[model samples]
Target: MTLFTELRRRKVFRVAAAYAVMAWLLLQVADILLDNFGAPEWVFKSFTVLLVLGFLPAVILAWVFDLTPGGLQRTPDAAPAETGVTADSGMAGREQLTNRVILVGALLIIVVMATERIWFAGRGNALDLPAAAPAAGLAEPDGPPAAADPARSIAVLAFEDLSPEGDQAYFAEGISEELLNLLARSEGFRVAARTSSFKFKGSDADIGEIGQALNVETVLEGSVRKAGDQVRITAQLIEVDSGFHIWSDTYDRRLENIFSVQDEIASAIVRALQLELDVGVETAGRTENVAAYDLYLRGRQLGREPSRAGLLRAIEHFEEALTLDPRFAAAYSGIAEAWVWLEDYGGVPSTEAYPKAEQAARRAIALDPQSAEAHAAMAFVRQRYYNDAVGAARSFERTLELNPNYVTAYNNYGDVLRDMGNLERMIEVHRKAVELDPLSVFMRTRLASKYIDVIRFDAARELLDEVLAEYPDNDYAKEELANLAVAQGRLADAIPEYRLVHFSRPGDPFSAAMIAIVATRLDDRALAGAWIEAARQQGENNRWELLARRPLVERDGDWAAMAELGRVTPGPEGALLRGTAAARAGDWLEARRLLLEALQLDGYDATQPARLSHMRTLTELAWVEQQLGLEDWEDRAAVVEAVVEELRRQGAGSIDENGVSPDYVMARLAAMRGDRAGTLAGLQAVWDARFLSHWFLATDPVLTPWREDPEFIALAEQVRAHAASERAKLAGLEVLP
Candidate 1:
């Protein structure tokens, strides 16, 4: 008799019950993992189908292996030994066919999965939200700064976990990072980067020392520890410059005290910072289970770098926790977080994975209404999808309210602010991020570089001094500082900085570009040509990739090079370079065409507001119009009018030919059109608004036409004197007699 028939006759349902239980347990774990880590519904659905398919074989295996009354069956040929050879011969043919069918089916499944994975390799394995959230007008905190003021700077130092024996090391570290991460969700604090904190990993540096190093006023530190089913935590706040530990705390609770810990720690830090929160602050989704929280932490530690293998491993650990406790909210959030990284950098396309990513984000949010992670995930989706700035700003704000010292939130906040032309404030935000993460080389260099963009050279120099003093080998900082030197027309001074940076990074584009510009200025044609060639080979240019193109493009004879540059580079400037090249080649039509296309691509971001909206976009637009043979005063005035009318519709005003600010661009546009009064009006408005020179107008190619006109030249002199007067007013500078 067959082994299956024998087991059925012997009432072997008991073993079948055990198999079912095992399968059910595995299913439960799979369900939780799929929700958290984010995979297509088919993955889990297929599990059920597989389980059903495997049932007969599983029963057969169990029955064959079971110690039944009749004894174990070695194979399907369970006939007596005497008849075994003949019986086996008859059954082998059919058994071989069945086995071949099973093998082929399994192979097909493997092939399908492998093909799907390969097809979507570029997009990554995790899902992402298509865009950030719709920007709701979250009521502003009282007396929000109108712009990124230099005086307003904040930093968050890494919190120390002070548990006995460091038993709560992961918990303390996770909580601190999470809380800071949550706070970073907003554009409120100019928070520091995480790498900045690495140097203090084990140091008990006093707040005063840290403050001097990071240049910030507040520091937060905390710890976590657990004993059996109970947990304990201690938190403290210190005023950085004062070296005063203003507050301290200790808490004891059951194992399921995760929510309480997060809340207490966050509330303490917020109160210590003396900051207000949006209504959304109270929306942080709370979870109480410590076991699940621990597993979530384990997963997060893996995902911090955002790698594919790391994320898959994290998903496995999260699965283990879910096996023990199925309804784990934090675990789901961790899974969603992994998926986002996977989609962002893990080479997984949104088309295939976003549905999974969305499900996890939704699940986490549904489970915990106050999840900053959930909100942030949604915000990322919105950014990618709709390019909705207003919505991203609100979501980011809510994220900060939920956690007040998040560095990432601060970084993203600066991004949105920069989009609005708040360069000074963007510099401040990056400064805050560097302070929070004092050991972060990238943040410090980036912050210092931003200061240079807005002509805050003194601030940039000061920051670079700090970086060079501590880590002289940092190439990005050294090279960027060289770029700053080049801006000041100090070719001699800039040479050393470029050489130092090039020595370290070898073929770094920023160094190459700067070297090329400075070399050409110094009359070293060989070095300049060498740099030009190297920059092209090194490959750089993006929002983050400032291809040293700026200095080269500004130099004469490089217009031809710009066409080459445009061909290789990406984004707005690529188009701008092509247009500029066409113009220099005497093809104004082509130049105008390309520039107009760039204007369309940039849309709202191309406009400058502080100058009242007459910035590069309008200037370029005006240039195109003028070159197209509409150079008369009446035609110029008409161009300004069209731009002004558009700005007015957007609740903004015009600036000048150059949209340094809306008002300024409009005024310049009006003046270029022969409206002397309009020119002065725009100039006066920008002056009053405290828009600094050394960055805009004078060197800006936008106002080339106006710079040649005598009437415009007279207005420019008046503005320079007026700016000096305004500086004196703001800072009480003395007018030397």
Candidate 2:
């Protein structure tokens, strides 16, 4: 028989095709990585697919011609009955087949090696640095403002593991993290991020290199040595710019005293940094029970999300910690937080969980007299469970006073302030959070979007752009970017970003909903339909019960689905879901009635209350209000505008609005009403926000009407100049992204 016929009989073609397909998959993966890491648009998925196709010819050649060994081992004529070969002969034939296989493998390896070496090498050099340098005023290691202040800039090095048993790595890491958190919580200090500082844990990076890398004025390093009940820790605070030891200490304590470790470390670090921390010695006493504290730590490590399973596990740990030391205030608070978290995450009823959260929080304070976590927990309960804004604010304030650098302090405080119409302070607080957690992609995104909330798209865009550049993989950024693009009428640019978001988080109903929205605009009915169906498949996702919330098409739908999830199925979020379903099902009045009923619960109800200020809820509420708009049309419209504006400003990241942002929506609405001035205002906001992509700004359809406006050009230039100035400030930075 012909070799081709023999190969067909042996199914060699199918085998070669399988290998080719695998090669193709690997090639696609490489392309995806490159794209995600900032590769050029010229890079195509089909490019990798074609690379696999290249192997097809070689594979087919092996099948078509019997030139390679092991090419046709399964010939039909070689059947055992027909060949009549003895066992010895069969063994000899197998040896020959093995030799053939080895030859084929060797050749294939060489081909793959050559292909990878040549094709992958040039792909890494995709980014093009601009010829013009960053503007003249860019700050670097040589002279950070913090360097001059000495009090604000700081770096935290890895703490030494004190445990002689050598299995306390998690403990040691937590200690360092807590110290970092303590410092981060303070408004008086500029603590480095976990990623930036932790990058040097076992590295040879000295104080000088670390200072330069972190761009800080002071560096803190310490070592821990613990044996059984006894522990010893030595720490030194060094001034990076001057290479001087600013403060030093060696501490010895019993393992049982680790309860006080968190507060003690915070005080020491503050003194070392020379900051005027209002918090002092008594604050350290707040960590009353070491055992309870340990339990809390163990609980934190148990679950990925705040689900009931994780919360239950966390509750056990927190309880144990408290049991080891009943006076442990934070442990009691931890138990409270865990229970409250479980209400939303574990799917328990608010009646069951909210009261528990409140009780636990109260117990913590009773036990410790002064617990930051306890205060925060109480605030959550009051806000979510009791609906007492005033009380919640008081507790939130207490938490901050106790620990100014608390990350959540700023977030929760800002949220409350916003509800009170204190937008300016809210922005300021979030700004502090962003500074403290510069490498926190999540915080930055929130900060940027908050800027948009006050109709300050310019600032929001700048922040969002920075977030996208540094953490392009963030679905939040991508969604906002897509929305911004669509707002600008740049459907082409907006589509890919939206699609990317849905693709990255296939099970995220919000993303799928956005994808559907964008697809509808782009006339991709099929894609839109497919995405909507997929969105329907993703269960409920939201957790909070709030009066106002970020505008979202899928929150009611998707989050309700999440409510049905085994964890958060029957809690406060579930109630919101039932309410949302009533609204979406065209029973607008019923929806309003249900939501109002849910709102009657306390602020401490926890989950949805925290995120209630979202524009989506406000917009829907406005619609419901409109259905009964006899008494307050102007007031209602104003409320709607505020909600819309707030949604527009969120996540802008210190820059102005872009195409996909809601600014375009307002601008268009104004234009349709012959509000030329308003249109111009929106257009100006978009241009001022340089955080968006050139592709998005250029392509979105929302801003199409504004394309000819003279103000647009001036605004764009101004934004670009501002961006240039900012980039110049980070010219020689390390890990601040």
**Residue-wise C-alpha lDDT for candidate 2, range 242-289, written one tens digit per residue:** 565554445566777664544455554554344555444445545445
The root-mean-square deviation over C-alpha atoms between each candidate and the true structure, in angstroms, is 24.6, 27.5
Number of clashes found in candidate 1? 73
**TM-score of model 1 vs. true structure:** 0.47
TM-score of each: 0.47, 0.52
| Worst window of 10 by summed lDDT in candidate 1 | 125-134
Candidate number achieving the greatest TM-score relative to the actual structure: 2
Instruction: Assess each prediction's global lDDT (C-alpha) against the native.
Output: 0.56, 0.56
**How displaced is residue 252 in candidate 1, in Å?**
9.0
Please give, for residues 234-326, the per-residue lDDT of candidate 1 as tens digits: 555555644444444555566665565566555544433444443245533433456666887888778765455787788777777777666
Lowest-lDDT window of 10 residues in candidate 2? 124-133
Clashes of each: 73, 111
